[model samples]
Target: EDKVVQSPLSLVVHEGDTVTLNCSYEVTNFRSLLWYKQEKKAPTFLFMLTSSGIEKKSGRLSSILDKKELFSILNITATQTGDSAVYLCGAGGTSYGKLTFGQGTILTVHP
Candidate 1:
């Protein structure tokens, strides 16, 4: 069975603050680590990491996976109120469409 856990179930930050979200997992035949952000509607894709150490980025958001450690971290720098959302982490296995997800971390950014 695959299992994912995210730390600090919720966070409160002000604009311009930097935040790091943690995710740890134990997955059988792990293929990749996936990150998502959910606001008012459906969740939006953030990053998918297959290789360890290398970081992926988009604007102020970035993420890195550590395969050996079986963990990943999502970073948001200079956060804005618009950045407030529920961050979700998932572990992807060899099977497509099969993922074990963590109970998201809710980030509330204040102006």
Candidate 2:
């Protein structure tokens, strides 16, 4: 069956720490993998991975995809309390942007 899995469901860290979050998936007809940050109500888009081996970075956050392994990783550096949020990864299949998401990785950054 096609499904998505995320590791380290939750983490707690002091400010300025670096963390790595993982997402793996298996889909019958894969298209892309997307990452999101959910701080309050709506989730904000982070990265969209369609090709493997290319890393996407924005500010202190970065992500990479491995199509062969069917997995992806999100890394955050110099974390801050404002960075505390739920990191979500969703896999898009051949079905028109339809995505199946992993549970989420909750990161707590304490000052």
Candidate 3:
């Protein structure tokens, strides 16, 4: 059975504060690690990390994978209230694309 864990289950920050989310996994036949952001209903895909030490970034969001450590980190800079959401990381493999998701880190950005 594959399992994923996320640190600091919840966070509260003011606008413009930076945040870092951590995810670690232990699974069989690991293929990829994916990051997503959920605001209201659906979780929006953020990044898919397959290679170690490679950082994926888009605007204020960026993530990196450490395959050797079986962990990943997500960073959000210059955060705004809109950045408040549940951040998720999923461990994916050949099991018909099924992913084991983390508990999720709830971020609250207040102005």
Candidate 4:
């Protein structure tokens, strides 16, 4: 069965602390790995890493993909209270945007 798993299911960090969220997966016909931030409602997109674009970065957030390892990592540098949210990782395959999501990593940034 295709699945994704994230480590450190929850985290608490002081302002300016750096944190890394881990996601590992097992799937067939893998196409891409996507990252999202969830606060309420549905998750919002953060990064999408494919064979052509294996690394993505935005501000203090960055993610890298390792197809061989079948996993990805999200790094947040200098986190702020505003950064507190649930981090979600998903795999995109031939299912046409159908995503297999990991149990999100909840992040709480204390000021």
Give the whole-model CA lDDT for all candidates, comma-separated.
0.96, 0.95, 0.95, 0.91
lDDT string for model 3 (11-32, tens) is 9999999999999999799999
Q: Which ranges of candidate 4 are over 4 A from the true structure?
A: none
lDDT of 2 by residue, 1-111 (tens): 779999999999999999999999998789999999999889999999999999999999999999999999999999999999999999988987889999999999999
**Candidate 4: residue pairs that collide:** none
Candidate 3 regions exceeding 4 Å error are: none
Clashing pairs in 2: none
Model 1: residues >4 Å from true position, as ranges?
none
Poorest 10 consecutive residues by lDDT, candidate 3:
89-98
Which residue runs does candidate 2 get wrong by more than 4 Å?
none
Residues 1-111 of candidate 4 have per-residue lDDT tens digits of: 899999989999999999999999897889889999998778899999987435688999999998888889999999999899999999978887788999999999999
Better of 3 and 4 by lDDT: 3
- Give the C-alpha lDDT of model 4: 0.91
> How much is 36 displaced in model 1, in angstroms?
0.4
Estimate the TM-score of every prediction.
Answer: 0.98, 0.97, 0.97, 0.95
Error of 1 at 56 (Å): 0.2
lDDT value for candidate 2?
A: 0.95
